[model samples]
Target: MSGEGNEPQAIRKLQPGKLVIASHNAGKVREIAALLEGRGLDVISAGDLDLPEPEETGTTFVMNAELKARAAADLSGLPALADDSGLCVDALGGDPGIFSARWGGENKDFNHAMGLVEDKLAAQPDAPRDAHFVCALALAWPDGHVEWFEGRVDGTLVWPPRGTKGHGYDPVFLPIGYDITFGEMDEPAKNEISHRGDAFRQMVAAVF
Candidate 1:
């Protein structure tokens, strides 16, 4: 077989300890850790290791995720998992897709960010309120081996952002077939159908 054919076939499975989550966001770290529960991987956050976050200069979700993952894996000398996720609103022409966190500004205030989303949507009342949450997960080894996965959950963007549970754009996002927002659901319930969960499951099957 050619090297090209064997390239993707090389799977680097995770060892049962000390995997780093390459993010400082408390919400992301907690959610990802929860999804990783019982997987035999000891999950730790970049914050826990005091690893400085790499600048996410990549445009797409996958690129950014890979950047973060590689940075952590190199710094911590451990396999690292990173997630780059966002709520993309169709009405806004996918505004804030990758820039979702930056929409929060220096304070990382999601309430302000949600209000901006609402304001933009409010300007165009005729536009569809449909949106989707996108998550890209990257698992990188210290040796530079990397595997990436992406997932999306379609939903609607609601006004008066409901619920107070989950973080980020959760309060305004109502997943399909459910009247409640992600912010309203408990960790277990949210983990079952989340974009992060979708990506996490794919990584687990391939890497863990």
Candidate 2:
């Protein structure tokens, strides 16, 4: 998928117009839309367009993000943005790095997945409880040009979970320098320090 010179050219700027968000997860789409608000671009999700969800065959976040972005761009004839994010645990040696969503099973039942996490950690009481959330953002053009950024926010795990504001593992991950889990923090506060937020800001600076 090389562009000119047998290499993909980096997109230095994104013109103000319509863009496709290559994701079907409603929570993810909402968060991304909120981030891009007031940026003079109309954002539409792949789900809204009834775009088929591509299989995420990549083993890493960046590769998966690029795969999704490119797939959406090709289908929509518009610049596309995609994010691949997950929680990595030090104790588990990153068991769920690329499989975070899979851990929730086909139904995407995160409550059961969280319980599994708690159960696994319980068996390793002496192990480190540290963990982090990682997010990789890819911006792809229909011509095969792509730009990407990755960000992480370190934190620790908490048993029994907490709060109900955020979804997925938010209720169990307590960010560094914070007394409350991500589930307890308001959207504005969480966005200011989230891995996705960090990656989005970098992408904005580089391409927008």
Candidate 3:
């Protein structure tokens, strides 16, 4: 992590050493790692360290991200990064904002969760099918100091889904100004415009 001169005084600069990613989701971990590549940091996941996943009691994405980052930093005695991201549909009033993972149940079966989303929206097909993906990122030091960033990408929901590249609601999400769904796009293309990508860039500006 190279600190830029314009970094805020309140934000602690990371020095690109061993940092823990507070997550068990392989897709998320992989995305984060890809975003952080070439930053010269030795990154490791909390799952790799056998750290227990903490219950996400926060009502908001930022709060949940902070909770996970704090837990990992405290447990590993190292700097940590955490991300809480989900899909929010206007028709559903953000039904699965924080419970995106939970909607998949203990097995984390996203296919089942996607079916539920489709079923819930079937009753009102003409209703506003607009949606968005939101990502909140938190970086924490061992001493509990934290920096937060949030990003979102507006889009519309596609019925029956499409593609198979990305995870979560990617197959059903067609981002604004794009012809294909997120799942249909390549990794680099998706990363360039995703909610997580935006949040990660903000974090890099603040502390990297």
Candidate 4:
């Protein structure tokens, strides 16, 4: 909802203090905390504070991330970080863009979601079936300053899930120029090329 700045903006160092990660998902929280830890930042998930899960009504990833970050910053009285991510398929016209999590309904059935994707691509023999995962990270300061960064990895959707290393759509999505799926890749390798990694790098550049 603001102008894009190519040059990195100033981001305050989080002082050897705790920063709340505004997310209910433990996996996401762990990943973010690990990333921030590399910068000498003490990170804690909102769940640790028993904060209520804010409804993600925003239409876009950036909006939703900002909404969560703002809420956490206001409630915790400290800087907050949040991320919104999802898989977007070009063949299906981005059917799962914002609804990637609950694509199978409120239960968040990954099996059902994967099945649906396979079914949609089954009939389209000539379909591109190209897909990518988009991750957007937002940081909100208590004083009302906010910054956002985004990253994506282009890939294609494959039938049948593969490895179990990563979570949520990782098994079926194969990044370009790679033979193995993301879930099959080692943790360090995946972290090096992942969308989250890119966004986190941008965030780090802004801060340190």
Candidate 5:
């Protein structure tokens, strides 16, 4: 922690040990944990540790993810990982990007959020349904070292959202070349090509 105003900091590597997943969302935590299952590190969540969620004042996914990860790491005195992801509809002007969770209202009811997206598209009637999901992952250390990675998956939005397996906007998202929505796919299948999976892969390659 003492090194400051010196040469550029080298990218830190994550050693196998107790790591914090800095998020309260159960679905996201589960997905990340599954991705890390084969790794040797023990994983825990910010929610499990009762760490207060930091306000996401960052404008981009990477910024927000770093914010959460650093906060958790500093508070818990352990290396922490955080993910910020969202659905961006091109027709909606990339809306619900960083505000994806807020679109779900107070309880984070994504069904309602999906409906809102549908309604917005309904009003347009002729706008393209092209959209994408972006995920940003950040790993932070208690000493303030940080790493960031980002991933995106392009797709189209469908009405009458299908399936109930995956969470968030998964039911309405049809990935390119896939007939089934993410919600219709199993965890392993979804993880094979999800935005979060992409980011996680990058982190694992560089860190673990």
Candidate 6:
């Protein structure tokens, strides 16, 4: 099928060939690789390559994802997939959107990150404390072609991290109309409506 500008779709369908997942985070790699399993593709994490991680300096998720994917594709001479995701809080004026991981300063401590959220929302007199997780997925080819997909889940923030199953801000994020935080939900249940799932599904539609 023709893609934008009548360019042939950049990605070939998932097959037996190797595809690199450009992420050092094991959680992100597992989630994405699971989605691609049994679809006739061999999904490998960049970590498996022991390659140096590219710095994520882009301000937006798309740019960051593209940067990572292209860097991996160039390095490995294979198609690469990368994702950049974060929690965006409305009350904080969408703060911690791009810097969600480093919000607590340079410690990279998740507990510290979660603590910052509580502190930021403690004094909100009338704000909804609404938030969402945004995920952007990018696929890059060694030939310089690229494709992107995005997904999000609307939710609200709560005090006190609730569950230990999930990482990042999952413990405080309650999806719309749900009583439990993402941390409280099982992995299968959460993936069904997760931002990563949506974006990955989009990429699958494009390729497979």
Q: In candidate 4, which residue pairs get closer than 3 Å at backbone N, Cα or C atoms, i.e. clash?
A: none
User: What is the Cα-based TM-score of model 6?
Assistant: 0.90
| lDDT for each residue of candidate 3 in 47-137, tens digit (9 for 90 to 100) | 9999999999999999899999999999999999999999998889887789998899999888888888888899787888889999999
Q: What shift in Å separates residue 46 of candidate 6 from its native position after superposition? A: 1.4
Q: How many backbone clashes does candidate 3 have?
A: 2
Angstrom error of the Cα, residue 195, model 2: value is 0.3
C-alpha RMSD for every candidate: 2.7, 3.0, 2.9, 2.1, 3.4, 2.4
- Give the residue spans of candidate 4 off by over 4 A: 1-4, 7-13
- Say which candidate scores most in lDDT: 5
Clashes of each: 0, 0, 2, 0, 0, 0
lDDT for residue 70 in candidate 4, whole number 0-100: 92
Candidate 5, pairs of clashing residues: none
lDDT of each: 0.88, 0.88, 0.88, 0.83, 0.90, 0.82
Which residue runs of candidate 6 sit more than 4 Å off their true CA positions?
1-14, 104-107
Report model 5's TM-score to 2 decimal places: 0.94
lDDT value, residue 125 of candidate 5: 93
Query: Can you write out model 4's per-residue Cα lDDT over 1-208, one digit (the tens) per residue?
Result: 1213555444454455778899888767877776776576778889998888788899998888899999999999988998999999998888788788878678777778888888888878899979999999888889888888888899998878989877778889999999999889876788788888888887777665
lDDT head-to-head 1 vs 4, winner: 1
Per-residue lDDT, model 6, residue 47, is: 95
Q: After superposition, how far is residue 99 of candidate 4 from its true place, in Å?
A: 1.2
For residues 103-207, write the lDDT of model 5, one tens digit per residue: 999899999999999999999999999999999998889988888888889999998999999899999999999999998999999888989888888777767
The TM-score of candidate 2 is 0.94
Write the residue-wise lDDT of candidate 6 on 1-208 in tens digits.
2123334454455446889999877877887877787777788889999877888899898889899999999999998988889999998988788788778666567788988877878877688888999999888889878787889999988878888766778888999988989889877788888888788777777777
TM-score of each: 0.95, 0.94, 0.95, 0.91, 0.94, 0.90
When summed lDDT is taken over every stretch of 10 residues in candidate 3, the lowest stretch is 1-10
